[model samples]
Target: HREAHAMQKDWMRQSGIEEEEKAPSIDNFEKIAAERVHLGLLVNELVLSRELKLDDEKVKTKLAEVTNAYPNGDEIRKMYEQNSELMDQLKSTVMEDQVVEWLTERSSFNEKEIEFKELINNNQ
Candidate 1:
């Protein structure tokens, strides 16, 4: 990041664009923040449209996968012991996913399949 900033400074010097001492007073900060929130909501909507779920079985499977990485790893057990609240939150997340999946099956959404490369390029 420092290197990028230094390069930017050099570029500014060459181009004769002075760096401002302070940020501009953008009157529409609230509007910009709202747009970012809306974009996040839209991205979640896209994921929900795919009928994804994170149910109890899914959570267990994920935990098992992680534990498999270290044969004698007690990280999962330690996490469960230390983070009871996190466990409950994970349970709620799983329940919410199940509900969303149920709703998605009944809801109407446009279906379009695009290549992963094309999707990445489009996002960029």
Candidate 2:
């Protein structure tokens, strides 16, 4: 366990990810783990979409829907419309979501349920 902790620290250093001054709670780590899993799924979906030659218009439509769902959605949409960088980021995120939807329609997964505690411990 000590070696693993050291390796994690080393990896953070190598990746230029700074360690927090205070250790994160288990819940915080769990949240991080969940986000990593989400990102991994999106990456897998993006690869699948590329292989299938999928159109990205669905993503754009979804992004518009999402923006409209927000409170002050018009202002939000205007902000994105005015800011190229934010617009690009929004587009990328929407594209990833679209890919995930397409992949879900075509792929099957084997599933097993595990306790959240077990999931967190196993990740550690």
Candidate 3:
């Protein structure tokens, strides 16, 4: 990866691409932070409005769905079961997905195709 990265950098230099490609400005950082906070607030509001609750069954199901994707599914499941922090994180993730699913079901979206780099580097 190191050699590939160096080659990529050389190609970028030769192509006259600026070195600040990955360097985001302060405004971008602020915008990203603000968007995160806004999303958090929206999720919280949705949870409270709908009285959504995360039950143990839901967490277990989500954990199973995730661990089953790995080769050592039982090992990963055991680790998540034993670790309170990991379980909590998983619970949060489950709740986030629940919120997103609710919004997606209730909302309309306009789909368009674009380059992957444009989507990821949009904030910059």
What Cα-based lDDT does every candidate model obtain?
A: 0.60, 0.67, 0.78
Stretches of candidate 2 exceeding 4 Å from the true structure: 1-56, 109-124
Candidate 1 global TM-score: 0.35
Global local distance difference test of model 1? 0.60
Candidate 2: tens digits of C-alpha lDDT, residues 7-102: 456556677778544433334445556666678576766667577443467656755887889988888778877999887767666656666677
lDDT of 1 at 57: 79
* Tens digits of per-residue lDDT for model 3, 1-124: 3433444565566777776565333344455556666886888899999998877788889999989999999999999999998888799888998888888899997999989999889968
Clashes of 2: 0
User: Which 10 successive residues of model 1 have the least lDDT summed?
Assistant: 20-29
> Which of the numbered candidates is closest to the native, going by highest TM-score?
3
Error of 2 at 11 (Å): 23
Worst 10 residues of 3 by lDDT: 23-32
Clashes of 1: 0
| TM-score rank order | 3, 2, 1
Candidate 1 per-residue lDDT over residues 13-65, each given as its tens digit:
67776853432323324455566457547646755786555566776755566
lDDT of 3: 0.78
Under the 3 Å rule for N, CA and C atoms, how many clashes does model 3 have? 0
Count of residue pairs whose backbone atoms collide, per candidate: 0, 0, 0
Model 2 C-alpha lDDT versus the unseen true structure: 0.67
